[model samples]
Target: MATKGRRALRLLGAPHITVACLLWFGVLTVWGTLYQADPLHGLHGAVQRFFHSWFFLAGGVVPLPGVQGTSALFLANLFASMLTRFERPSRAIGLWIVHVGLVVLFLGGLLSRQYGRETTLVLADGEKASMSVSETGWEIAVLTPGAEGRREVRAYDVRNLRAGGSLAVPGVPGSVGVVRVIYAAVVSPAAGLTPSPEQVTDAPAASDPRMDRPAVVLRAGDERLVLLGEGPAAVLHLEGGGEAHLLLRRARLPLPVSVKLIDFEKKFHPNSGIARSFSSRVEVDSGGRAREVTISMNRPYRHGAFTFFQSSYMDNPRGPEVSIFAVSENHARLLPYAATLIMFAGMAVHYLPRRRRT
Candidate 1:
């Protein structure tokens, strides 16, 4: 057992291990970039299959190590080399500083993987929102309308559930089965056909997101209900008076503070029609008090555990300006800066004396 442990230590401390890790990282980066270029496979798909997994089938045949596995192995190799190989103080101080910086960068990536949470908040002019919705997380909500603006809701998680998948609807009588789903759908009324939200055309030719609607079908107790996400055909009349609304929406996270968009301003470059800058004037409601603030490009609003950045805007042209804010909550958000400063200090300490000798 002692001999085996020594051999393992030696192997981990080998320069070949580091070289292999770096080469694999390069391969993964290239693979991810190439995979996302395919129209059917998006960046999120590449992340889920390549970056988040331990191993993935490349080209549906060859196996490749993913980001998590490669990084974990590389980090272990680094620590092993630090303990077993980098023992002599006579070693170059510059090398030690670079190793420490690389370690910190790896650790920061791990921290982000564990603690970073991101979502988006979309607010129209004169709209108020107290929550943000995830861009990727999907949920199916079963809502029963009660008397006069009251509703009882039960939501089921259905992120990336494919066709033929079935899930039980809580508080409802029967199970719901997915017949068809279009992640990005276009909805338009066909001539001579009655315009109904449940009426859907065939799957789109490509991901041309003009209307940007999502169409889905749910089978419930011998009745296949055609539903559109947040569309007019969302609500169904029960046997009795109340209505059942089947909604497909992103999972929501409540915020401690509510924001009301009072006004939005956008400036275009001369003769270009490209937007130079856009901003939103918002009223923040926090702890029973309200304050006004403006959020713009490069300017973020930080409150509690969340930071909101003005990321993008959706222009309605004839309607209100739709402001989209990227919300991120990262526990180790400042670690990168700390690591950068440490690297800078280490570089200065190592190089200044050597320069003086010359």
Candidate 2:
């Protein structure tokens, strides 16, 4: 067992491990670069799908180790080298400093990946919002009437559902079982069907053809109902008494403060219809205190751990103008700067000592 352990240590500390990881890293970079030309992933999609994953498909066909896997192995190789290869005092201190810098950079990246969040906040003129919704994730919201005629809301992430998934909530009659999910569908009323005031129009006219709305069929005991994303929520009458309303919506995150859009201004070049810039003036309400801030093309508003950048605006000359802010919350935002400084210090120390000797 002791011999096996020594062998394992030597294998981990081998120089070839580092070489192999670097080779794979280069391959992944090139693969992702080539894959981004296709529309499936887009600019950010390649990094999200391939670079950060453990294993991902190339061209949706070939399998390859992702950047995360290669990085982890490279870190392990460096750690093993520190333990077994750098034990002697004669080793160059400059090289050790460089390694330490690299370790710090890697650790910072890991922390950012684990804790960082990116979302968007959209507000029409004079509108206020306290929560921002996610761009991708979907949720099933159950709205029921509570005591004193107040409404209560409970949300469940749709990612947790499957063909036989069951949901049991308090005050709900029987178990709610998912029959099936239509990932993309256009709900149309049957022929000779009468349209109700709550019924939504079938499939949007200008929506992307590739895009699909989610629809679900759920069963509770003997009753079954179909819920469509384009229409009003399916209202279920409970056997015990009250009513339950189920609607599909984007997952939301609460903000530390609420923001109200005061005004949106757009500038145009002289004698041209082209836009020069756009800005939004917003009032932030935290607790009972209120403050006003302006966000523009290059300017961002920073509060606590959140930063809001003016990203876009809707074109509405006659109606209320809407502003979109790209919200980013990253605890390790300064990690890259610190890592760069450490690397510069390492290089300077290495070169200055050698120059003095010369």
Candidate 3:
């Protein structure tokens, strides 16, 4: 009688669990495809709701000898026991490796999500920064007092600034000129201006400033026009745009270490015009340890806790200079590597032995 009752419960519970899994899988598939277009769309919401509903259902339906999901644990242990009992050696080995690898992968993902740091540092043609800001995209400017005075190092959050927009510098009156960001598709020359299909009634009226032959006329307030070249500073003549006390300065973040670009080298193969290598000779000063290092395409330099790689290069007729470093730190990056190794080993053993047997 007890055996029959247990069997009946299993029959009823199996379909519910299967249906719940299928629903979750469908939700995941739809969410993955549409997430980019409309992140807050209904499909994403529905997936979260479905998971919560089914997880609750699963909790109630599955009987536990002690706690709730403990039943899953017991079921897994029972399957293992059955495999061993039936002398299914190959299946048991495969299952053990696969399960262990999955567990390791999950733990690794948790660690990385909870603790990962990524940052970018931009040094001018010959400037140095004292701190690094990665996620917030802000750089700290450390101002050591000059021989005559002591000014506290000011912290500046510099991002891509608009051409006409104003930025407030603390203790200094008026706004500074931040870089103007122009989207290639949205900007066109005044001589060749065309209305965009997606342009709304409230869109700004401006011409695209091309890099080939660049010119910008930025309006401040309701009046005044400032003509800007590609240079660091531009003058604005304003009727009522205040006294123009602040000069327009480009936005840049400060780094902890100072880097001076000593020299840049670009080389190509002798016979073929194909480029062979590009590198930068940079002088870096961190923690009073000053050293010069050459960072090339795959080669990176390590200093203390930071690794600097040659990530990009800029070429002009005068000379070609390369940018160095893309920095990242994840405390739990080894788990994926271990999982990959385990998977590779399992595939090797399974296939090599099968081939030998054949």
Candidate 4:
């Protein structure tokens, strides 16, 4: 290697650089915890500022390195150390394996952050579905009823739309535009106004974003329709004697496999209204085959890259029970475990001796 190149590698592998990165990492952890304690900046804000970004504007002005940059620097240090310091072969085999394991852990975390997804799968007894819903994103769907009661759905993402912004929905005549969006509101019938009256007024937005009930006003053809996130579908009669149902709802994600709620059971406390435990018997159908599995409080079911846990349950006074599963997809699910095992083996090789020194 060139003289400059060798010097740069030595600098990268310096112990002081490693120490500084570790100290910065600990500072970030402490600061993130303290920042989340404030009501204005919750856990999401802290994560976005500290973990997601490479650098953040400290106090909305000065730039400061975050966990992302720190991790990158730490990784560079490890690589440089392997290339510059651990150049021998006879007695450094275990050290090489240990370094490789540490590298895997850092790279695995990066891959997981880029590809991991978290969503909810909701199913009622005897109902099977292959789609999960996003927790915070909202969409507008237009459903046209077809033969055999099946509806053709055309959904548009409206989470980024501002007040009075428009959406050009396919197969719908004229313009479809949004007038207003309320994050949380009280919706009611507007009484004697025009042909019908759909009234809505604003309310306080919930701190937990999932609890927010959003409403959107859309101009479909010539009629103005009010659609609520968790409300009933509004119908718009088309010019050709057909009708389209308008709905504002959480965004749905298509899944690789279908899951059905075979049975849902929950046990209450000994004598109180609080629930003690719940479980779901689900049938996962994939690749033309089906199998049954139980997902309970601590036991989660894994299929392919997705894992499902019994997150919550709901009991209707007049209807059936609903089972909600928290599903997460992590492509690097086993990387951490593999890295840990490799590290342990390397440590044993480096330290353990069968017949010598205590």
lDDT scores for all predictions? Answer: 0.76, 0.76, 0.47, 0.82
Candidate 3 Cα errors over 4 Å, as ranges = 1-101, 106-119, 122-258, 269-274, 303-305, 318-324, 333-358
Separate clash counts for every candidate: 0, 0, 12, 1
Model 4 TM-score, 2 decimals: 0.73
Residue-by-residue lDDT tens digits, candidate 1, 1-358? 9888877887886889999999988888898888878878667767777787878887789987898888888888877776677677465566567668777878887777767878999999999999898766556777876658888777766546678887654445655788877666555656122234355666643322223455667777767766555554355556656668787777787788999999989899999979999999999999889999999998999986689999989979899989999998877777777778778877887788889989
Question: What are the clashing pairs of model 4?
Answer: 190-197
Report the lDDT of model 2 for residue 152.
Answer: 83
Between candidates 2 and 4, name the one with more favorable lDDT.
4
By TM-score, the best candidate is 2
**What lDDT is obtained when candidate 1 is compared to the true structure?**
0.76
lDDT of 4 by residue, 196-222 (tens): 224777877654566778878777667
lDDT of 2 by residue, 1-358 (tens): 9888767877897899989988888887888797777776565667766676877776679887788777778887877776677676345566667777777787777777767777789999999998887665567788888889998888877768787987665567667888766555454465122222233233432222224466667777776766665446877776678888888776676788899999999999999988799999999999989999999999998878788899988887899999999888787877778878888887887789889999
For model 1, what is the alpha-carbon lDDT of residue 248? 75
Estimate the lDDT of model 4: 0.82
Higher-ranked by lDDT: 3 or 4: 4
State the displacement of the C-alpha of residue 122, model 1, in Å, after optimal TM-score superposition.
Answer: 1.8
Alpha-carbon RMSD of each model: 5.7, 5.0, 13.7, 5.2
Ranking by lDDT: 4, 1, 2, 3
Best by lDDT: 4
RMSD of 3: 13.7
TM-scores of the candidates are: 0.70, 0.79, 0.40, 0.73
